[model samples]
Target: MSFLPASADAEFDLLCIGNAIVDVLAPVDAGVPEAEGLVPGSMTLIDAQRADALYGRLEPEQQTGGGSAANTAVAASLLGARTAYLGTVAADALGLAYADDLRRAGIFYPTAPLDAERAGGHSTARCMILVTPDGQRTMSTYLGACTAFGPADLDERAVARSRMLYLEGYLFDPPAAQDAFRRAAEIAHDAGRKVALSLSDPFCVGRHRAAFRALAAGHVDILFANEDEILSLYEAADFGQAAAAAARDVELAVLTRGEKGSVVFCRGERTDIAAQPTTLRDSTGAGDAYAAGFLFGLARGLAIAECGRIGAVAASEVISHFGARPEGDLRALAGV
Candidate 1:
């Protein structure tokens, strides 16, 4: 069997690096959390024992492949951009499923699975997503083998082959992963390719604020973040302050606000792009989808404003679905 399908023969337009996780989603009433004594809107990492305990308490409605950066890579590929993903998983059922899902979505999958001891004894990285009637999703994650991912996991050749390298802020949680991120950044820079990063979540920003600032100032050429994440990163009192601070640090800063739309800042020029109108469904992958569309636009040489528009449309489509992965051809949805 081919490692990469025939469709991946050419040099990729983008390469993504981060944890590889599978998402378990279930629909429940908004009040279920209060009744079950579970926290809503916060992702907590649990050990294998805890994961089993939680798994036993509920019914799993669906299983799908996910990870912040991996989701963006898959979405970008579906938008007709050549993409590759780098991450680690155990040599277990979930690992195979994750790889297959990326491959089927037209993304180049290059990471190998861990040994049996890692897969069975320790849980695979799994996110238990609880969706409410109001289209809100609360997530509980078990990092498991994902935390074991480190610098050695990176594929330097693949990094050099891509036009851009994209990373997620969540990777900073594991100290070992920092080396891999730095290595990928160096490789991408040495090869004259752009490097992009998504501030995965507000908690992630709070966890690695200093390091993130250093990265934003030096390594990251393109930066993506939502209002809350940006505020946390800069320790700013409001969104505007954070956006201005980010613009001064990076070559391009794309800041997204849920209902207000998104802002693109580049070369001292700031432009606001209106959000595409859509009935809200689940906001699970809105940020990732927005990053996908924006990256896709950049890869296709579209203007910054047009890129933000594409990002908004992509986000709108994902919010109208239950899963983090896009349900249809996003290129068609973006009218590209």
Candidate 2:
């Protein structure tokens, strides 16, 4: 299906789909990961009991809202794009907090909360992030009530009204959620809206490589991945091979190589954009912010190179702060 720009009267520029999770950020020494028997730089899905045990070990420095696609939706809104989010949450305190955070950030989140009584006695989803002084963040997420998300939760009119549908790869963990993604993609495609997908993590890519490949080839117009994730997706020996493989499936493929820079491949052309120079206070939401900026540029009909530059600038801003949320006006940063 061909990608189409949103009409002037469209309700939103972008719509994001993913889990809804609150982030509990804690600054810890480098040894904390080992102490907790965790692998550094990896995102591990934990049970509610494990989440509590991990939370008890680290002193929380701050609490913020974060979910891969939700974070991107917030960033896109901050960058001056009309944005919406679709995800599930229970009628609990954390769920309320998550909705409040999204609303306050100017994101349209219309998903009705699940009834508290029928929520399987679970709270909302949460991610416990341990940040090191060097700006590396390791995450342990408890999916919690978000696991209840499925195709039934999607609003078809809302999906059709947006110019683009942004999906998070993390949602592939559950079979029902995978169906939800496929349904959303079909709706977006039928409406002539573009669809983008992020290969959230290397492990996530490894888990659903075949499905991801087919989806990217048939439905996705823009594909996002990091060095390790793209390599894992193609089972390639190196980034070059992975990038080459990616170019054949999607019209646009954006590969982020932390610190080194990012590569944007469109059609048969490639553009290498440098990472903005900034102090790395935390790397928690860099990719999400980058996607937000890129989507904002695309919504505005900016050239591909400008889109990549805006993405780099947004990523730089997120890494310079302590959380995944934007601290300043990204529109001004991009000189839009």
Candidate 3:
């Protein structure tokens, strides 16, 4: 695919849409997870009661805006992109906080909030991350009012004004969210903008492989996935087969392999990007941050090899910290 410079009149370099969540982080003893009947190093969906109960057990150390696409949006903004985000949040305290975080990150978050509490609907979504002594994170996510995201909730003007639209795979669980994303993708394409999709999880791919395949083949111009997710998408026997299959579906296929590195396939060419060296602190959000860097570079019309390098550098920064978003100066690190 040929690259185009973003029009000066464009309001946004990228527009990201997905679940809006508040992430609560805590450090706990190794035995704490087993005692609570929780699986370590796993992300499980929980109900409101389970969310409340598990939260009470955690002595949280930090709370920040986090979710697959939201994390990418924040990271992209930090990389000097004119970014915007669209995620449905309830008119609750956590929801308000999620908006505030995007503001601080220099990303515009359009608010057409639902009063979930008054309407007897769900509250804001939250992920409770429990870090063990081994530096492994156990996450319990409650996808609350973000499921209420539908076609009506989208910022149509923002979709048209942005140069690229990024969709998060996790939000595909809700039937309405699926419709909403499809609608957003159509608007973006109609306006001659690019559409990118991140296969958020391997399990998420397994759940909606058919829908994902259809969307990738039909609408998605840029595709992002880790090793396991691509395998799940095509049920391919190996990574090579999965990579080749993905290259056939999308205009640009970017696949990440932890520790080893990442590969990008575009215009019948492959580019290998070596992983940047860094201490393994926490692996959460590494892929999300990588996508942010890659997309930001693509938005700036940078070469594919340089984009991959920036992505690897961004992933390194996130993993060296405890959270999904970077805590260090990423622009300085990547030398943008």
Winner on lDDT between 1 and 3 is 3
Alpha carbon lDDT at 13, candidate 1: 84
lDDT tens digits by residue: candidate 2, 99-125: 988999899999988886645778899
What would the per-residue lDDT of candidate 1 be over residues 70-164, giving only the tens digit for each residue?
Answer: 88998898899889998888887888888898888888888888886644456568888888989887777888778777878888888988888
Over 1-336, each residue of candidate 3 has an lDDT whose tens digit, in order, gives 436445666799999998898988888888887787777876788999999999998898878998889999999999999999988888888788889888999999886668855324888999998888767777889998887888888899999899999999999998988999899999998888999999988878999999999999999999999998999999999999999999999989999998899999985579999999998877778889999999989988999998999999999999887888899989999999
Candidate 3 scores a C-alpha RMSD against the true structure in Å of 1.7
- What is candidate 1's TM-score against the reference? 0.93
Tell me which of candidates 1 and 2 scores higher on TM-score.
2
**Prediction 1 global C-alpha lDDT:** 0.84
Instruction: Find the 10 residues in a row with the least total lDDT in model 1.
Output: 1-10
Worst 10 residues of 3 by lDDT: 1-10
Order of candidate numbers by lDDT, starting with the best? 2, 3, 1
